[model samples]
Target: MQKVVIVEDFCIACYNCEVACVATHSRSEEPIKAYKRENLRGRSNALVEVNGPIAFSAMCRHCKHPWCLDTCISGAIQRLDNGIVYLDEERCVGCWGCVLGCPYGVAHPNLKGEEKHAFKCDLCIDRLEAGLKPACVEACPNKALIYDETMEETEGAYNR
Candidate 1:
């Protein structure tokens, strides 16, 4: 499964990934327009955390055995063969079950309108289908986020 990995030493805590993530997920699909539109609220699935001089981004790990999938009573959460865990908003009941079930605390409630639903990173499946990296990974100016690499390659990267 392709996953985003943090190169913590390279992170500058710029929060660019968060901004890019929100823009990509926004209804307007533009950072400036999304910010200006009150009804077009967007939230970053990836959250930046700073501890002393260290900073890292946190998001869904898309676990092999996702707790959110198992705990979802409405069956809105499904794990694809490629290991992407997706939430079907139309089938969601806004029960916050996934929110509580997610070990990484990545799952959140959609608060845009009267009707609520669960939200989280879908690994930018649409972008991946278009042969593009996830917005967060692509926006990292410091190259802190790396994705779609073999285990040996990842180990070699850090070894350097």
Candidate 2:
């Protein structure tokens, strides 16, 4: 399965990945529209962590056996054949089960609209289907994030 690998040493704490993620998932697919007009400035799936001199970007790992999928009471979380853990917003009941179950704390609750739901990185399934890399990976100017298809899935591989 494909994964977004983090080159922690190369990260510069830039938030371009977060911006690209919000814009890509926005209705207008534009940074300005997504942030200003759509009020989605901080609703990015990709999160950038900065600790003094060290920094890195993180998102859903799409684990082989996702706890989010198992804990979803509404059956909104589904693991596709490609190993991507997807959350169907329409089916989500705002239960927050997936949020509490996610080991990485990447699953987020979407309370912006009238109906609440959950959201997370889908690895940009639409972009992948269109033969393109995820917005976060493509927008990293320092090449800190890598879309790696050859990554081996081992237990606690993300502990690094």
Candidate 3:
């Protein structure tokens, strides 16, 4: 399964994750160009918390038994065996059930307020297919976010 473990002991609240998320998800989809603007918030992503030693940064957990997939009567949300979850916008009914069902509150609707539909992290599946890390993981100067599929990479998450 695709996942990221963030090491809070080393995080500096630099917001590299937030910016990288926007760049990877933006309509332009270019990190260099995206950084030229003042609107880091322009993309469909968010930063979680900023304080506490060992404080965790969160995104889609892709639960073993997903409440989002269960509550979504429209069948918009589904999980793959590898444990990455995604919402099919075409099949979605603009129902907020998935958003409500998500324990982590990762699935968001109308991210920028202009968009009526919702979206969330799919573990940056596109980048993963290209043999690259998620943008947030690559952008972190502290290397707090480690994108890996092995059991060892997930040790930090379990400890938390």
Candidate 4:
């Protein structure tokens, strides 16, 4: 399964990943346009976690057995064959079941006002379909984020 690995040593806390996530997910899919609208209130699916000098970006883990998938009363959350966890926002009722069920606390409620919905990382499904890296991983200047098949392989590559 494809997974994003955070290389904590390389993280600089610049928040570029967060910016890229919002831009790509925005209505216009443009950074400038997304940031320009006062009502836009773009939210990044990936969050930059900080603890003093230590920081790293985090998103959905696409768990082997997702609690969010099981807890969703509306069946809005589903797991793809390839292991991506997807949310059908049209079906979401803002019950926050998934939000509370998520162990990593990545799932959140969308408060942008255009629509009340739940949001989390779908591993940038559109970009994955186009054979491109997730926006957040591509935006990292220090290469702190890595997408790969396994943690061992990802770590081995970074170690060298």
- What is the TM-score of each predicted model, taking all chains together? 0.87, 0.92, 0.80, 0.89
Q: What's the CA error at residue 43 for candidate 3, in Å?
A: 3.8
Task: Give candidate 3 misplaced runs (Cα > 4 Å).
Answer: 31-42, 52-55, 152-156
Runs in model 2 deviating more than 4 A are 154-160
Per residue, candidate 1 scores C-alpha lDDT tens digits across 41-75 of 45778889899998888888877789999889998
Per-residue lDDT of 1-160 in model 3, one digit per residue for the tens?
Answer: 4677666667777777877898887667776666565343644444556655544456777677888898888877888777888887778777788889888877877654544666777788889889898888888888677776874533234453
Name the better of 1 and 4 by TM-score: 4
Candidate 3 weakest lDDT stretch, 10 residues:
151-160
* Candidate 4 overall lDDT versus native: 0.84
Clashing pairs in 1: none
Tell me the deviation in Å of residue 101 in model 3.
Answer: 1.3
Please give the lDDT score at residue 3 for candidate 1. 75
| Local accuracy of candidate 4 as per-residue lDDT tens digits, 18-131 | 889888888888887887863445478889999998888878888888999999999899999988999988999888888899998899888766778899988999998998
lDDT of 1: 0.83
Residue 63, model 4: lDDT of 83
Better of 2 and 4 by TM-score: 2
